[model samples]
Target: MVWFLQAAAAPALMALAAGAAISALAIRLCAAPVETAASAAAVLVGTDEHELDADDPGNLGGPHLRSARMVRHGAALSADLVALSTAGAAVGLLLGVPVLAAEGIITVLLALGVAMLAAAAAAVVPHRGRPGLERAALQLGGIIPAVLGGAAAVAAAALWIPSRYKDLRFEDVGLENFTDPAITGGTPTPRTELEPMIEQALTDMGQWVSQTDESQYASAFLDVLTLYSVTPNVVVAIALGLGVLSALALAQLLGGAGHRFGGSVLRAARTSRTGGALGITAGLGSTALLAAGGIALLVLVTAVLNVLAAGVPSLALALLAHAGLGALIVAAACAGPLLAPVLADRPEAAVGLRNAAAAAATGPRGVMLLSGLLTALAALGPVVSALQLAPRAATIWEDRSLHALTPSALPLLGGIALGVLTVLLVTSAVLDGARRLGANAVVETRASLLEGRGRAELGELAEMVRRAAAPALVVAVLAPIVAGFGLGPAALPGLMIGVALTAAGLGLWMIGAASTLENAAAVIGSGRYGGRGSWGHSGALGGAVLTGTLRAAIGAVALPLLLTTSLVSALAVSAVVGLSTDGTSHFLRWGVAALAIIVALTCWVIAATAPEVDLEDGEAELSTPLFARADDAPADTLAAMDWEVGDEDVERTPARARGKRRRGAADDDGRAPEDAKD
Candidate 1:
């Protein structure tokens, strides 16, 4: 519940996210043919179509070819994102917006993770593999960029071309001298997208010395940051990142099938391929890591772990939503690389492996588009509000919005809710089982490429696949449970209408449960209580909460109890218990909201006072001089004197001399020069 509250978390989150995002991108792009062929024999072409060894995992050639192919896709997604973030970082120097620098990197990666989870969820419902709504989404996505770019280009040309030619003569045109605004510092800039982010990052880094706290490296760190911000490192790195990402995205999406050289790899046998299964495994790994991050972020922001205690199911649902979106964006980018593979080596097709590898994203240039879409859809406003697209997006950020959602407090009788949630979890599992029923059902008649592999090897391979897919699958399914607790009540009803997802549950169940058990054991095994003061009050509160939690757990698993009474009757008892306890005394004094505010303020104050940020001021000076004259600026340049300077030179404001009037002994008026001047 309190992870994002820490400073300096953005970069680490992004680094891991980028690594994970590319895994899916690699599989979707370069090794998709193997995946498709493994799924259904009909997807292959010519000789390869009939040669399909559906379960082999060897059809994409071998480990070498598969891996080699994935390199392009992996590089495209990672490098592009890095470049974009770097550019944002650099541009942030100008606008004082630090978050912009890395915002694309984190949000986009998470968004892709989210998208994939969505696809997994959709898989829950049965479908023929025909394009439906996605076709429109693709068309809309494709058209918007083209139209916007064309419109912008035309406007720029119309505004600039006539003016250039208006003053043109053949002689003048040939010898044009350009004015450099760089020297004069009149350069305009984008909005302050990066300032706050960078400042926050800087503050977090320098926080040790901000208050009474001390660290030996604190001063040194500030000095290094000063050097970094003051120099062109930020600018150079950012510009390089932006330009490179832009070029790569364009080249990959627009690259021709024919090589710059006349030669091609199209006729190369599929045996030349490399390890394709690894990409899927990588995709799985990346998905899980991303889910963890998304879950952590939500837990911190939503106060799920607050003393008030939110509906646990709600937290689970939100995390899943994030995972689903992130997966989808990543999946879309993967489409470019995978499309040709899906086509296979058909006679009519000339597409090759190399052509599919260089693909990457989703907005301004497809950054976080899914998040925007989700927020727009989930906003608790009217249809008229939806239609008014650009009318003050403040509503989109309101507390009511999912982006700012505050989970409903966990009811005292929430044990029944857990049981209900468990039932929903069972249902989601059933749906997912149905989803896997038809995936790649046709195994080829040929001896399995993996036939000689031992039982252990097959089991290991199956385990890898399962582990890889588990994060996304688990998130998707658990998210359905949250929906039952009244999260998102959109189109789907009686199933997945809302989400109550919390990634904390997954980690706790999978990883933290053992430690939790260990703690309980140690507590139970202790000879006697010694830490508490003379009075037992200190431990008593935690004890009550712990024992109460145990009771609730017992109630949750007691199916006979549920059977003995109707659901309504059971619910009534739970409600009675909750109402009875609602007004009773408890440990909370300031409450969770107050604590959250205090923590936020402390973090902000810490960041606001961070050292080594003065270097940014210097960088600003180098980028743009205030663009207005300061009172103390040097008087006008001597070289470009006005034609009417004789009159203009007469002090315009005589009462306020440019220089302080001199009063000294050197003045000779008559008697004693010093006395006369005085």
Candidate 2:
């Protein structure tokens, strides 16, 4: 009854303690800022006044008159408020010593550590290149280092403290009394008495099983157990490792293939294919690494959980979930490369790969079907067990100790997650770089086969591709990290959705590029061969057509992949755990929403680009400012203009008739014959 009462009172006591802490901190926070503001105001206005300026509006210098002065005062108050709030929490804990002086020090250190963690938590939001983001970043930067320092100090204290009770019998100095070479047959004494030794052993074992406290011995034990689990589960370990490697390879294959396809389309286009190859290569490598890392991590984490659960039906279900997550992760990883060709206006390459994949998937559809069915059956083990004749079997399979078993799995899981993050970040950085390169290429000059002007355009294109790739890669990687850090698992689905969108965008870019290249080549060739009448259409229109097609295909593939993949599924699961909601329903809602958005965006983009044809042409037209303005000007001025319009300026005449007409006109006749008209 006493214990129960104590337990019941504990919750209320804790709540009261927490409330007191907050109240004390708030008081300090409020007081410091008020004092600071008052001092600043006195210094600025030469008097203490709550208002900024005196009654005169024109006199800005007065305490009661100037808005700027008031603003400064406000700023000071805000800064002081923050500093005091943080510092108060630190000081309050120091003042309130719950235990002995030594324990109090420990408590204060722990409080400081908490403060540091809180600061870091506040900084997880993205602040890069955004309005006010820099300020946030800078503030976070300052806070994190301080927090880290505090954490280090706390950790040192924690490490120095005694891990286990020194009162244990084995620690007694009297154990040394048992030392005797002759009686013990030269064996050294254990130092502890016989009865104490037995008691201590049992106590140690109890501690080990219970994981009662953090200690050097406990940590070492856990580490050894983890290592043992990893070593013995060789099959699972190998599978996990291979999963990562294979995912990487697959991503690379997709990226490379996409890159190649883009290059091919660009080559057919007859435009400069400067960074296309590099983009393809980087894209492929990045994709592969990310995909493999994600897969390896999913497999490792799920496997650990499954084994920990003692092969309960839940394990199979978890594995199935993990497999789905792996697929999504790989899909997300490959998106950039897969969409690369399309973005480059390389429809042929994109189409070829797309067709090939679809055909392959469909060709062995039965195998896929059988495999899926078997997997489903395996996953249903838990449900089947619930309906089984042997209830004892289920009970026998109940989860045992997590301590010994989870160690191995945790490391593998952490490594996998880290690996995936590394790959994604690297890939995103590369892509972002490429994107910037491509954008810059618009102005970049190169050694061209055509005129100086044409060379400039090609150079621009090359530079654009090069610059853009890095940024694209950066964006790709950043998304994953931001998702993981800021929103935990919920952020993952966002990435999948974002990747899908990006893939679609890239695809359109490729298609448009291919069309433009083809048109340019045709135009140049026609101009050289005097085939203007036969072929004089603008390249921009064709490019637009290609871009539309590319974008469409990307959207088609991306939407499904994003909706169905494991990466998003994992995120959904995480959301469920963190938010305590139904993951399946949440994911379904998200997928449906994404699909709708994709459909809407596709329609909107297609409609917008359809009439204009080549979206890039408008930009090209803008680039040729003088030429465009001239074309738009009066026809008379255009005719009189000295600027060359290529062969378009030339007069037309039949081959044989022109000479005969000239010769007849030259003959000494007052009036030229009907056939000799000039």
Candidate 3:
């Protein structure tokens, strides 16, 4: 009850905080971190600081005492997307260039330059090619996975296309309808209305799903890959462009979800075992709820979309399609936790799980927006080919999609994404804010009073609770790996989800405790430096500005990559998946994908070396800037105060709390110390 009461104070503070009243706009934009901070504070107020010791993990530092910048946390995270793209782009070009060479469209100079770029992208993983040629060779092995998958996709396409898409020849379809009438007589009548056409297509699709073997889905996917790949240099160009766009979506995922995950896991480690366990349980429940709620939210908005779709059917169709994809992502994310047992002990489960998240995040909104712009240009190749070149015996398969699922749907989704974006900007912003608020209030208030302690026990209790949670963390991580070993090749996709959930769950457990600490410190800090004339407030504001700008700068980098690498993996992965027929080669195909993910991530890790700095100030330089200096950090990672504070400001904070903040704080270096007594 008290927790909710404290959480209720957040909006009031937002409204009452000195300059907070100045802008609702600012509140909306920055609500994510602010809400997170506030929620963290309320938990501490309700906490029992007993049954723990200083050696506990939750005693580790949090972002609260020193202001955490959204930028410093996730600035370089987009490197993951870039790495995927270059590896993919290399594979695509290597596979496609030969076709061009056969056609005599390729030049020596062009091939060399393309090769160099790909090599460089591959080499830059983790950092300088320090992993040596052997590692590079391993990364080069990444191409094997995609190639293996692509070959399988092609084989799959061959068997399925003729059986099902054998006859897509419509009288009114293609360049034949748009060409000069003199050659093909007058325009045909009885044109189909798009709504009915789409309806019929969807109806057929439903029927297909009900009756067809599941393997046909991959066969169906391969159909799209064929068109893109047959285009010579165009495929490479298109892939590079998509890879660029994918970087943005990836960055956001790492910053938003990954950051959340990392923080949660770290905090869980810092909390009491029982509290962490309960926190984990609650988090899983929330994840399920959020996913369900997101779908329900989308479903509710669908009526509004329906009205719009009635007026502009194409636009609505795209939104509807993107909505379906979004629903799937949410479903997958939520369900993955339930399936965590399947992911344990995989060779590179973490890498695969991260892939799933990145794939989901980029596919719906990001892909739709970027690909929509290129729709006109993308259409030109097919239009020109269909009109100029005489249709080959097998050309219909190349030029046209089997059904409504192909080009039109992708472009429509993209268009809809762009169109509805501005309107939904506020929607997303409000959502982030609301989520932040709801998460803290519920968790903290309910779990605040686990066990009570004495007046003299204030500081001791907080430390105890934090440490208690530490030991249980090992079980959380290892359980999945152990469970996963009992599984097989089929676990590939599930592994991705499980990894995601494990990360989410671990992080989820820490939320209440971390939030309690950070929010409390923030509250105390706010009051201490609440004055408009205070240096602390001014410093915080400056840090906020710097971080906001830095984040924007990172976004700027992603914008161009959005153009190139967004499709890089899609092209590469699809091409690979298309090579194998569905089901028959399921193990082989997914195994290839797993290998690719492992190879790419492995190269990035093993090849990249982090050099330690012996200098004292190096810790500060290495640490996230704009955050509080280690010297100023509270005894507890989140704050110096116990659950209780006094009427006198000085009494609330213990001088002993600042005596030692680990060797890292005292000596300014955690990574390098002779005695290594942290």
Candidate 4:
């Protein structure tokens, strides 16, 4: 336990510190351009001849002046940080304290130590630069020393605190103590204690497999499902709906963040016109890819671990692998969403990849910390589910004497829900961070990329399909196929109905959710909502929130409707099967074929009608002094004067002929017509 704690604690603290420093520095650097622009505006508007002090708030003068100065100085940056940190901290405390309460003083000390170190690093790092991947890297480089120092301090404190508080069971912090039977709903047993039971179950499974004939394979499969009572129906619908809704919320958040980050990168590139911007954008994208790759690797590793558990039966090794897998998943989830929006905004794939990597490596530390904390919270459901299944497995082994037990669907459902929520929250945080960083970047940038309005529409649709595809396919295609082969002809119609309902519900939900998210993004990006902190921005955000909430609510309400429809369809098909006794099997087969066609056609239509995003031309709208203000005065006032015409002639003889007349006026004080009177 002590060794595990040491292993986990060190890296966790280091990452927390590093992420905090990076986030703080990114915040400052991203705001620099906005601040500089604001300062220029302040100088232009100053009525006094005296140079205004940029650093001194007192010297800023009047309310309007101060407001201008504050805006120029990146007041929104501070406000953003305050909001993010306050919310993040509240979430972190709520999740972390309870989870780590068993660790007692050690957890508190480690948290405090990490916080202090991160703060010091953030304070010491230089944050001035063009707000992009390269600048983030420089800031990250500056904070390395501070992070290392903080880690060392934490380690020293960890070592000393246990000695001082001798009563603290530091050794109890291992995996053995971490498992809770109450939460997991299983009798908590050590690997060594459960090894005998595992071996007995394996032996029984081997005997059963040996006795089963090839013709009885389908029957065996059906028996397994019957024993587990795992059927696709209303429960599946509810789970699918919840999962899709969560994914939609996440996509909305990530899309918004990506747009803002892209805007910032583009603005920075415009000001600097350097190749570095492209490199930075590519790096950010790569970082995101790397995070995604890590997730894929974790999935593979988890599969391998499961195989090992079932085949080789190494309890200790499996537990260790599980622990490691959990950590890796959390880390990947944190890094992936955080950098995804920044990378996705770039037009060039290579640029996005590089920038994502750089941002991941050197961007906001606070974001990383928050992501990690949230990931931990999201992981709770899966961990608890796993614990709950442990006892169920033991029961299967003791009663049925089966090595491979089909687990209840409840754990999987709970895990999916929790996973979706995690993704949503992480994406939201990422989007919010990107928005803050890019708030000022929008002022000078043109309406290029259509402000992500069009792109968001298409992106949201694609995102919905991507997120819901796996779960829906599993329920619709896989479940029915399995039931057809395993449960025989009678069970086919019920499974077919399940497939149809799942497909229809998923397709409908996807369209609705995508539309809502895209509309929200369009409203927020329109600038009608006052850009960042304005009342308009607030309103836009409110509208977006309401849209997402409403969509989720609608999905929830519609779940029962879907379930009821699926049941009726199944009942109708079953009645047909029973009535057509002579050709019941043929009738069932035709029914299944018809259902499959309907599902396929529905999916195709949804895909075909998905929104398309058109990229905007890069050209900026022209602005010149010639049209600085409206020319509202009379045309004659603006017309060029004929210098050859005398002043008296300009007002006399027809106004048109005055231009042809020479300078033939009388005295300066006399009437101009003195000469013309004759």
Candidate 5:
């Protein structure tokens, strides 16, 4: 490990330098356009001269003003980085394809060009000051693992290629025999002779294929499909999913370290450290627990599904499996966001969870469809890349065996490209999930405080529905049609099963993980645990860590059992009817049944538990009045009287009005001026 670290250091340092430079450049470029617009607006408004310099103390906005700008710029830069990285990775993979057709110095130059373009594109995204650049740099760090992982994958694939092609022999096609004669006779073979020999070899191969048995061809095709399409896709999905979790873990660690550093800096700066230490401890503990719990839950759920599918052969069981799985998915999704509030030391988090469930139950179709669509989009890149590899590898092997000395690098390069793209997609999804959950939690908490009720707000529910509606509709309507055409009836059942499991499992896992981090952060920021050395803080931290470990243990045991059950069930079913149309229909029926069961269970749960509003503790008093107006005077104050006065009564009217005003003012004040003075 030491040696590996040492070896990696050089590239790491180089990448760090490059990243810093790119960030600096990007910030300058991004700021220019925005700054220009700001200047133009200032001029248009005739405030150009009066405009406050960002560094001027008289500006009054303080450091927070610049910080807010940096955040906005950072977000924009982050989005641009996503797009740029995908494009660069794709370009690199595409460029590698030409390397197979022509291997030369130009190809190497082109690769260099691709790298340069990626870096340049990254630098082109607008950012603000040094802080904005630093943020961009941090985001850029995420792309490294993706790029390195892709390269490593490609290298591994390259090594594996020869084994797959080892059985093929050129002599069997009569090309080697024809070419060997001229060399054996000590005579140079003419270009014409070689060309004819290659043509004849191709013709003979075509003839052989035409004469091959249909059953043999069909079997071969099926073997290829299973090997290339089904198996690789499953493996890729699992591997990438694990990679995402690992990345999130690393990010959490980095964030914790940064938080600690920031706290130390604050302490050094003479800021109040009271409760800071305790907050950090509790936060760390909660974060660990959440991460562990989420991972364990995912593993356990996956294992159970796998076991049941594999172990149970009963058609009824297979049909019913989806309902159980769907229910779990719903439970996880609703419960996950509430974990945020839970970590915040709020007992009301439970109420939030109940409300979330109610919201989900009210719109199960939208939630499931949206979750499914997002899952599909996330997995699509990796799956397609996996499927493409088999055919690409086959083609490369055939071509290289006939003419080249080495395997083509295209497949592995493509894998690297796709892997990077997958990482970006997953990362973006995770970030988006966190943002949405955090926002939802804020909205729910505020609603509870103002309304004295913990019910889901209409705006929040509507936003959820709106965001999910289109995607859900597309996936619901299009997925089955695409499956029918692409996978065929026999394979469709397995595909559907896999999709359902993956979509539900992955969606829940992402939500849980994201929410956990958000909630933990909120707890720490809330400063409820006391200072650094406080017992409450330490205890919270310890509890969080313990929770995570326990969850992990549970998952470890649960997953294996589930996997065993699935495998056994699947084998039993196959033994009875095999993978036929009837078997497929049985699985489909089970899935539908599962959906129904889940919907019913969710509805029941929601109906049984209502959101309990806390009307006491001043919440009811804080509730906004139905007829409240922003411009209204104090409720105790009487309205001013408007009167018309004739000349004779003018003098008397002024005195009377002044006396009445004094009396009303005293009444509104709830005290007489003379009594207040005494």
Candidate 6:
């Protein structure tokens, strides 16, 4: 009772400490800004300038001094000071209090809303120009994350508090001890402290029981790998690393293309087939290096895994299995590009499809499968090996060290992690190359498809769809490889869930991207507000597709795994409880099931969402400010704008565009055109 009371009170104490610290920090930070603003306002109000009645513009040659501006400015500054202080107080209180309490999520959400509104109010600060709005925007962006972090902390505290109960009251539960019959017997066991009646009951009930295999290490391992079956922490780490890698690869590849191809490629692709062809060729040539890098990456991972697997006795087969699996993944990744163009309707959609296809083809499918398999096998290997060695060894456990079981598993996990990173780098490269090629190809094909009307376009679209669908399908096919290596004989079903989610998500994105882009031009040509709506529609579509993909993937994996694991665990527990079993049985029957369900659901959600977000939507429009604004210009206005720009283009036309090509145009400096000019 006392322990429970202490446990419950712990969260309150922690909350108080956090709240107090936040309050102090907020108040301290607010002091300087508040004081400075107040002093400035007081000076302005009391000065001779205020008595001069700037409200009379005639005083400066007009009627009213810009008193309206002055009042607005003063009010804006005052509002900023007030908002800053209020936000600070809220943050401090939120932090100081235990956010994990029942009210925490709501409290944090409320605080977020208040803080954002306050930030907006602060933006009215009197300024001479639009730059003040920009300043406010920057501050708003920075503060939102801080608010989110505080909320996450609260949620985390809540998650942790309840979990602490298991730690405080629970004892270490072991598999071996639970299986031993004599130790659980009614009489006191001579070998250990286990009550004998319980041991006898288990024995009579035909359950094996033992008291060994109690290494804290195994528990930690289980906590790490098995806790969240999908989107485990390891997977999230890998996904984040991959996302970053993809972004970098994209930047580098595009930057290089821009440097080599020149700006005309964009207009050329739009106007002339010859230009489109040349641009596409140039893009492909540039992107080849990146794809080659990916190929090398896959090969390296395969070689490394083979080498390491060879080092272990029984693990060699597992390594071979992983290699075969990797071969399939690599094949699919390499092949996906070839298929993407066939599946797409628009050029850009095709490019995106190809990019996703490449990522799907090349990503951590093999490594994930192999790692999961190895982790499972590693877990079971010990028990199975121990049981097999039980009769032969001096002591069943003396010779059946967990070390024997862990060798295959530990390296598998490590190798998978390393392999995942390698795959990410290469996959990113493949995607970058695929996008470059696809973009160029798309520009070329879009006209062809549009000109041909239905038949040829439909054929092309079907082909592109097939291409886009291929990589994800291949990934799905290869998931069984993981199932084969994994521990539970039925583990294949779980692996399938994850694989299906990934494939379905990829497919959905491909379809959505295609459908959305087909309408981009029509939507953007409407009007300024229409353009905003178009862009918003595009963005929303992209977001929804990505979100749906992630959610589906996560749900597919999590729902089934949770339902299966929990139900199975419940059944196991009920059986033991019905038999009136020992402490081991009690823990298994009750405790493990809940943990399994929680872990499963968590894994599903995390695994599904992180990897395949809307990078293009986030990055592309933002990069080209004009493109971002393009949708806002009405068709007539855009035509007029183009005519005006075209006149300038004609006046400043480069001699090269008129076929006045200069032989050996390259500068003696040997740098690319842009750099050479510099």
- Can you give the TM-score per candidate against the true fold? 0.23, 0.23, 0.25, 0.28, 0.26, 0.25
User: By descending TM-score, how would the candidates be arranged?
Assistant: 4, 5, 6, 3, 1, 2
**RMSD in order of candidates:** 35.8, 24.0, 25.1, 21.2, 23.4, 23.5
Return whichever of 2 and 6 wins on TM-score: 6
Please tell me which model should have the higher lDDT, number 4 or number 6: 4
lDDT by residue (tens digit), candidate 6, 1-678: 112332233234323322332332222222222222222222122111122121232122111112222322244323322332222223222221221122222222333343354334334422111332422332233223323333333333334333321122112111112222322333333323333443444343322113324343333222222211221122212221222233223223222222212232222222222332332333334334433443343344435533543232223222222222212222122222212223332235433232232212112222222222221221222223222222222333322221223435442233233323322322232232223223323232233333443211112322332233233222222222222222221232233323323322332232222222212212222222133233333332233222222222221122121112212221222222222222233334334434544443443344233222122544543433312332454356654563344666656878776333122333454555556435
For residues 17-130, could you state the per-residue lDDT of candidate 1 as single tens digits?
323333332222222222222222222211132332222443532332233234423543344343323222211121211212222223233333333433343334322122
- How would you encode candidate 4's per-residue C-alpha lDDT over 456-510 as one tens digit per residue? 0111322333322222322222232223222322333333233223322332332
lDDT of each: 0.27, 0.30, 0.27, 0.31, 0.30, 0.28
Off by over 4 Å in 3: 1-291, 302-317, 320-569, 577-678
Off by over 4 Å in 1: 1-283, 286-348, 351-408, 411-436, 439-678
Angstrom error of the Cα, residue 25, model 2: value is: 46
Candidate 3 lDDT by residue in tens digits, 173-224: 2311323232223554232332244335543454534554533333332222
Question: What would the TM-score be for candidate 4 when compared with the true structure?
Answer: 0.28
Tens digit of lDDT per residue, candidate 5, span 408-488? 433333323332332233223223322333334333434433455523232443233223222222222223222322222
* Model 5, runs deviating above 4 Å: 1-133, 144-146, 167-608, 614-678
Comparing 3 and 6 on TM-score, the stronger one: 6
Q: Which has the better lDDT: candidate 1, or candidate 6?
A: 6
Error of 3 at 433 (Å): 28
At residue 394, candidate 4 shows an lDDT of 23
